[model samples]
Target chain A: MTAAAADKPKKLVIIDYSGELEKTWATMILASTAGAMEMETTVFVTFWGLQTFVKDKKRITGENWMQKMMSFMQRPGASHRKLSKMNFMGMGPWMMFKLAKKYNVAKPKDLLEMAMAMGVQFLPCQMTMDMFGLKREDLIEGMGEPVGAATALQLMTEADSTLFI
Target chain B: MANLDIKLKVDASGLSCPLPILKATQGIKTVESGELVEVIATDPGSVKDFDAWAKATGNALVEQDSADGKFRFVLRRK
Candidate 1:
C-alpha cells in the first residue's frame, strides 16, 4: 500500500437491516469498539434497522392507516426491541439486561452513546423512511443525513472493512 | 517493577471485551509520549486485544502479567 494509504485510519462500514435487540447490540458494540480503536466507523441503517433509531414512545406514528399499522406492530425505538429468539413474552430482554449488568457490559443505549461520543456515524436510509412513513423528527437526535443505496455503497467501497448485520 | 513510573493506572476489572481496550486507549492519550499507562482487566480476551491494539496503534506493550484472575498490562504511548 502507498504511504498515504497506510497512514490513513482504517474505515469500517456496517450495513444493518435487522432491529432485533441482539443484532442492534452487535452493531453498536462493534461500531463503538471500532471508534475506540480510532477507526472511521459508519453504520448504514435501512429497513427495520431504521426502526431502532426511532424516538421512544413515538410508537404509533405514520402518515396513513397502513403505515400507522406497520409502526404500531413494530413499535419503533431501541428500548422496545425484542430478541430474535427466546423472547419468552418479554422475559428475554429483561434477563439479557441483568446478565449484561452483571458482566459489566454496557447496555445498547449506552453503547450507542459511546459510539456517538467517539464519532461513529449513523446514516438513516431515505427510501426506507419514506416507505415506512417515518419523519426525520421521529428519529433520535444526532443522526446523520438520510442517505440511499448509492451513498451506502460508496462508503462501503472506501471502507477497509464492511459488515452486514 | 517497583521502579517503573506509571503515568496512569486504569482498573478495568470485571469489564467485558473492548471496554478494557477502550479504557487503555483513553488512558494512553492522557499520558505523554513514552510515558507508561497501566491497565488491569478481568476479561480473558484482553490479552490478545491489547497486543493487537499496541501493534495497530504503534504503542509499546512494555509489560504484561496476570495474577489472581486479573490481567495487567503496561503500555508506553507512541
Candidate 2:
C-alpha cells in the first residue's frame, strides 16, 4: 500500500436494503464501530431499509392504499422493526431487547445516536422515498439529503470497503 | 503500577463490543501525546479488538492483563 493511502483514514460504505430489526442492529453496530475505529463511514438506506429512519415509530406510512397496506403490515421506524426470523409474534424482539439490556449493549436507538455523534453519515435513497410516497419530514432528524442509486454507487467506488446488508 | 503515569482512565466494564473501544478512543484523545491511557473492559473480545485498534490507530499498547473477569490495557498516545 502507498504511504499516502495508509496515512489517510479508510472509507467504508454500507448499503442497507432490509428493514429487519436484526439486520439494522448489525448495520448500526458495524457503522458505529467503524466510526470508533476512526474510519470514514457512510450508510445508504433504501427500499424497506428506509423504514428504520422514519419518525413515526408505530404508525403506517405512505400515500397510496397499496403503500399504506405495506406499511401497515410491516410498520415503520427503528423501534417497530421485527426480526427476520424467530419473531414469534413479537416476543422474540422483546426477549432480544431484554438480553441486550442485560449485556449492557446499546439499544438500536442509542446506537443510531452514537453513530451520528461519531460522524457516521446516513443517506436515505431518493428513489425509494418517492416510490414509497414519503416526504423528507417523515424521516428522523439529521438524515442526509435524499440521493439516488448513482450517488451510492459513486460512494462505493471511492470507499476502501463496501458492505451490502 | 505507580511508575507508569496514566493520564486518563476509562471504565468500560459491563459494556458490549464497540462501546469499550469507542470509549477508549474518546478517552485517549483527551490526554496529551505520549501520555498513557488506561482502560478496563469486561468484554472478552476487547483483547483482540484493542490489539487491532492500537495497530490501526498507531497507539502503542504498553501493557495488557486480565484478572477476575476483567481485561486491563495501558496505551500510550501516538
Candidate 3:
C-alpha cells in the first residue's frame, strides 16, 4: 500500500434516524469523539432526526395542516428533544439529563456544539426533508447543506466505520 | 514525568472522554512544538484515549499516571 493510503484519516459516518434524546446523545458523542481523534466524521440527519435541527418551532409545519400541527406540537432544537422510552411526556429526558449531569456526562446539546466546533460535518437528508415538507428556513444554523441519499451512500461506502442510530 | 516543566496545564478533571483529549489537543497547539502540556481527568477512558490522541495528533505522550481512578497525562507537542 502507498504511504499516503496508510496515512489517510479514518472516516466515520453516523446515520441519525430517530429523535430520541438518548440516541441523539450517543450519536453526537461519537461524532465529536471521532472528530477529536482527527478522523473525518459526518452525521447524516434524516426522518425524525430532523426534529432536533429545527430552529423555529412554529415554522416547522410541513406540507399539510395535519403534518404542520404534528411538527409544531413536537419538540424543536437540540435541548427540547425527548427520549423514546419512558418519556413520561418529556420527563424522561429531563431525568436522564440530570443524571448525565450528575455523572459529568456531556449533555447532548453541548456534544453537538462540540461536534460542530471540532469541524464534524452535519449533513441534512434532502429527500427526507422533502417528504416531511420541511423548508430550508426551518433548520438550525450550521447545517452545512441539504444533500440527497447519495451523500449518505458515498459516506457509508467510504467510511471505515458507519453507525445507524 | 513530574520533572517535565509543563508550559500548559489542563485540569480536565470531571471531563469525559474525548473532551479531555479534545481540550489537551486544542491546548497543545498553543505551545511550541517541543513544549509540554499536562492533563488531569476523571474519565477512565482517557487512558487509552490520550494515547490514541497523541498518536493521531503527532504529539508524544511523555508521561502518564493514575491514582484513585483519576488520570494524569503529559504530552510533548510536536
Candidate 3 — which pairs collide? none
- The digit string of per-residue lDDT tens for model 3 on A1-165 reads 223334878889999888878888888888887777778899999988888877745445588887777777885677888877899987888898888877777887777887888889998999878877778888877887899788899889999999999
Preferred candidate (TM-score higher): 1 or 3: 1
Clash totals, every prediction: 0, 0, 0
Docking class of 2: medium
Segments in model 1 whose C-alpha atoms lie over 4 Å from true places: A1-6
User: Candidate 1 has what TM-score?
Assistant: 0.91
Model 2: share of true interface contacts reproduced: 0.48
- Residue A20: error of model 2 in Å? 0.7
lDDT of 1 at A31: 86
All DockQ scores:
0.42, 0.49, 0.44
**CA displacement after TM-score superposition, residue A21 of candidate 1 (Å):** 1.0
**Colliding residue pairs in candidate 2:** none
Q: Candidate 3: where is the Cα deviation over 4 Å? A: A1-6, A56-60
Q: What does candidate 1's lDDT look like per residue over A73-112, in tens digits?
A: 8788988889999999789999999999998988788788
lDDT of 3 by residue, B7-55 (tens): 9999989976657877886788789989999989999888988877767
Q: After superposition, how far is residue A46 of candidate 2 from its true place, in Å?
A: 0.7
Q: What interface RMSD does candidate 2 have?
A: 4.0
